[model samples]
Target: MLYDITHRTTYGYGSDVSVAHHLAHLHPRELPSQQISDFKLSVEPAPTVNTEHVDYYGNTTTFFTIGNPHDRLVATARSRVRITPPLLPNAARTLAWQQVRDRCASDVLTPDSEVGEFRFDSPNIARRPVLADYAAPSFPKDRPLLEAIVDFNGRIFRDFKFDSRATTVATPVDEVFKKRRGVCQDFAHLAIACLRSLGLPARYVSGYLETLPPPGKARLIGADASHAWFSVWCSGHGWIDADPTNNILPGDRHVTVAWGRDFSDVSPLRGVVVGGRGHSLGVSVDVARVAE
Candidate 1:
């Protein structure tokens, strides 16, 4: 499968900005299952300084500085990607949850060793007793890791409400637990927190999930939004992506942009501005399947 993705972000500042610096993880990642054949970033009022480099997590990042004052900033990224993923392994056949957890803390370092760092606190997710209490029901003493993960994911999807207005990027996992309401981001964070509470390695994944409209309805232009999910480390299988928002394992429909300890590490965009009273932001993402 192949896809053409376009993501556009527009910002309107109440006051003109004299200078700004920004970072973006808008470029798609290249993996055996997915390839970023080509990518480009377009900025209105081209920046005075720009540079690209890979971050600590091996994610492609672009840093740019704008010197001229402007009341608006728009960033558009276009990319072509190819994906051909193998079928997911049977969840029940995977290692037991405790075995995976034991491996993460051991001194041995497999290629999947780096995943150990994710089993702790991050800006958005922290280790809390409540999280573990909420998640314990899914993982009995001898449950398979993936099976437990899938069940936990479904629980979140069933118990929570997908309300866009319920939370913000800054919302805490604790708040989401109380309200049981949030968009994909909150669910992802909530799950990440739950896993970490159990001393398991889990990380946040930022990406786009191809969404389809009703059977007879026309696809809405730019109606789709960027999505979030979490990945857990399995001893032999490596990282497995789980989507609590949709209660499914991610595959061809998932386009990974970046992964990190939490949303703060892989935020699509973040920056410092010299001047700007306040701002309103709008974002639209479209993912279209292309013929092989």
Candidate 2:
């Protein structure tokens, strides 16, 4: 599937900002199942310095600094992407959850052994017994990794409520557990915590999810929203993406932007400004499957 994605973010400040610097993970990274083309980034109140570089996990990151004073700022990204459904080995054929965890835990580490790092705590997700206990029901003795993980995903969807106002990006995963509610980001963090508590490697994925209108209704221009999900690495089969908020495996409708230990590693746009106190922020995202 092919997609044209547009994301715009605007910040209005009560006071002018003397200077600001920002790092954006807006550029889509090339993956085995996705291709990107015709990508562009635009920043208003034009920056003095702008550059792009690959981050620790190989995701493309762009940096820019605005030296002049400004009361308002806008940043936008446009991209054309082609995504193919990721393939997975038969759920029943994959190794048991315990065996995969043992392999990931082995001390014979290699330079490419980044997966192990995710099995520990991160800036947002913390490993705790509560998380492991939540994941326990999904893993029966010798359960295949894929089967167990999918069931876990379903459990989260059924148990939690998706409420945009229930939590913020800074909300703790444990609190979210008690509330049983939050947006996609919170759910993604909770899912990551659940897996890590069990010594499984899981990464937070940030991107877009295409929205289709009802059969007889017209599509709203900017109805789409940024999406967050999680992926678990299987020893032989590779990574599998799942969305607990929507209770579906990411496929044609999902456009992956970046993956990291958690959201802080791959926030679409984040920065520090000298001033800009009492600011208001607004964001709009649109994702459409382009015609052949």
Candidate 3:
């Protein structure tokens, strides 16, 4: 499958005279299952300095610096990618969660593959026994790791509320677990913490999910939003995607941008400016699959 993605972000400030620095992880990489055929990015007013590099996790990161500021700033990223991701059956057999976990743990998982590990004490995903215990509903010990993960995903989706106003990026995993409310980010974080607590390695995924409209209704434009999910390392299957947000596996519809141990690693944009105050940000993204 191929896709044309266009993303726009704008920021408005109460005052203009300032400096801004930004890091962008919008570029996609060619992998065994997915390939990036063509890509490009543009920034308005032009940046004084811009640089691109691949991070430790192999994600393409672009840094931009704007000085002699203005009242508002806009950043737009556009790309046309030709992807030939494996079918769900093949992906299940090859990229299964069990397979990836073993490969990653043994240091054999390639950069092109979706395998990663994070420290248990990562800031946004702090570990807490109380929360884990609370989240422990019940599961059969004899179940496969992937099956267990699926079960957990379903439980979370069924029990928690998907409330955007319930939390922020700064919200701790423990708090979200206690409140039992949050968006996809919170769910991914909570799931990561739980998996790690059990000595498993899991990573955060930033991407877009092709949303479906109600039966007999046309899909709405701009209604699709950027999404977050989690991938757990399985001993035999590789890194498998599990969307705790909806308790479903991410298949062809999941368009990945970048991945890391936590949100900090794969944030679409992050940076520090020498001088900036009262700034605002707006982001828009469109992802659609193209027929061969």
Candidate 4:
């Protein structure tokens, strides 16, 4: 599958800004399941300095310095990517999950992918007995690690709610688990935190999911925004994709842009500026699932 993605973000400030430095993770990388054919970023007001480098986790981070005096700033990123991922049978779930967890436990931990700050001690996700209990159980001693992960993922899907307004980025993982309501990002975070609590390495993923409408209904634009998921390291399998939001493994329809230990690391854009009391941010994204 191939896709054309256009993302535009605009910031309107209450006062003029003197200086601004921004970080962007909009570039796509070639993974086991996907490849980046072409990508680019453009900034309005012409940045005084712009540079990009690959982070330790293999994600591209772009830095830009804008000295232009303006009340509003806009940044746009556009890309075209080709993805070819193998489709594993649903029955393979349990085996795949176990494989990923075991592999990650053995290898694939770099300084970048390592869990830095321990949020588990804060009672966010660690306090949840259910998550802890699930992590404790030894499932299918003879089963592959991937399979175990899939089994755990299915349990999460059945137990949680897919509520969009239930939580924010700052919401505690324990609260999210108790409420069982959140978007894909929340679920992904929860899953990562839980895995990390169990001493396994996991990473956050940001990308677009190829969505389909109900029978006879037209597809909606912006109705489906870019999505968030997670990956666990497996030995021979490498990093395996898991969509806790849907209790399924990501395939070709899952277009990955960037990855990191947490959302802060892979945030689409974040920055600090010299002057701006109040600001309004507007984001517009278009992701289309096209023919091969």
Candidate 5:
């Protein structure tokens, strides 16, 4: 499957007087199952300095600065990407969850051993006993890692309500656990915290999910939204992406952009402004399939 994605962000300031600097992670990742054909980023007001680099987590990061004063700012990213359906690892064939956990903690350094970096707490997600308790039911003694993860993913999908108004980007994972309601970001954070509590390695994935319009309805220009999911590190197989929001392993319909310990590490756009005060942010995203 091939897709064209457009993500636009606008910031209207109550008052503005000086410079602004921004960072973005809107570039789609090139993976074995995904390839970016084209990408472009345009910023209104024209940045005086613009640069791009790969982050610690291997995600593309962009930095731009606007030296002049402006009351409004707009940043837009457009891209074309191709995706092949992922070949899911056989859950039953994976090592037992406990073994994978213990081995990940061991000092032995293999090519994939670096995944241990994700086994601990990060800025936006912290391991807690309660998170382990929530995960305990899905993972039994000696259950295969991937199999248990699949069950846990499905449980989250069934238990939580997708309420966009329930939480904000800064909502605590524990609070989401208590409320049992949140958008994809909350669910992904909750799941990552749960996995980390169990000594398993997991990371947050940021991306776009192709959304189809109702049967006879015309597709809206920007109805689709940015999506979030989590990935668990499986020995030998590497990271396996799972969508607790939709309760399925990610495939061709999912277009991965960036990933890290949590959302903060891969936020699509974040920055500091020198003089802009009380800003209103507006975002619109469109993920449309293209004819192969």
Candidate 6:
């Protein structure tokens, strides 16, 4: 499947007088199951300097600076990409969850271990006994890794309510667990925390999920929103992505953008402004399918 994606971000400030700098992670990733054909990013006020590079996690990072003063800012990214469904291993045939956790733990002692990096705490996700306890039911004695992860993902979908107003980006994982309600970000974070607490290697995935409108309703432009999901490492399978908010494994409809320990590492757009204050943010995303 091929798709064209548009992501637009607008910021209005109470007052502005000076410079601004921004960093963006809006470029679609080129993966075995996904290919990026084209990508373009445009910034308003005409940045004095604009550049891009791949980050430590292999995500395309765009950085730009606006020297002139402006009360408003707009950054938009457009891309064309093709996606194929990823092959997944049989959940019941994979190694036991405990074995994967033990291997990850042993591997963490090695210096510069890549997989070990995600098995620990980050700014947005922390391992706690409560999280381990919450995840306990899904992981029984010698349960297969992928099978257990699927059960945990489904449990999160059934237990939590998808209330946009229930939490913010800064909300803690324990709080989300307590309230049993939050948007996609919260659920993804919650799942990561739980898995990390169990000593498993997991990472956060940032991307877009294609959504369909009602039976007779026309698809609204910019109706799609950014999506978040989690991935767990299976010994022979590498990383397998799962969506707890929707309780399914990620496939062709999911576009990969960036990934890291948590959301803070791969925020679609974030920055520092020299003079802008009392800012309000608006974001819209459209993911349209292309017929062959």
Point to the candidate with the largest TM-score.
5
Give the per-residue Cα lDDT of candidate 4 at 239. Answer: 63
Cα-based lDDT at residue 268, candidate 2 = 95
lDDT of 2 by residue, 200-247 (tens): 899999999999899999878778999999999887877888999998
Task: Score each candidate by Cα lDDT.
Answer: 0.91, 0.91, 0.74, 0.75, 0.94, 0.92
| Decoy 3 TM-score against native | 0.85
lDDT string, candidate 1, 1-292, tens digits = 7889999999889999999999999998888799888999999879999899999999999999999999899999999988776467789898889888888877778655567888989888889998999999999998999999999999999999999999988999999999999999999999999999998999999999888999999878798889999999987888889999999888888999999999999999888888888999999999888875
Off by over 4 Å in 2: 110-114
Highest lDDT: give the candidate number.
5
Task: List, residue by residue over 1-292, the lDDT tens digit for candidate 5.
Answer: 9899999999998888499889999999999999999999999989999999999989998999999989999999999999999888889999899988888888889745668899999999999998999999999999999999999999999999999999999999989999999999999999999999999999999999998899999999999999999999888788999999999999899999999999999999999998866889999999988985
Q: For model 6, how does the per-residue alpha-carbon lDDT over 1-292 read when each residue is reduced to its tens digit?
A: 8999999999998798498888999999999999999999999989999999999999999999999989999999999999999999989999999988877777455422458668999999999999999999999989999989999999999999999999999999989999999999999999999999998888999999999998999999999999999998888779899999999999899999999999999999898888866899999999999989
- Candidate closer to the true structure by lDDT (higher is better), 1 or 6: 6
Whole-model lDDT, model 5: 0.94
RMSD of each: 1.2, 1.2, 3.8, 4.0, 0.9, 1.6
Candidate 3, residue 60: Cα displacement in angstroms equals 0.7
Compared with the true structure, model 5 gives a TM-score of 0.98
Worst-scoring 10-residue span by lDDT in model 6: 105-114
Q: Each candidate: how many clashes?
A: 0, 0, 14, 17, 0, 0
lDDT: the better of candidates 2 and 3: 2
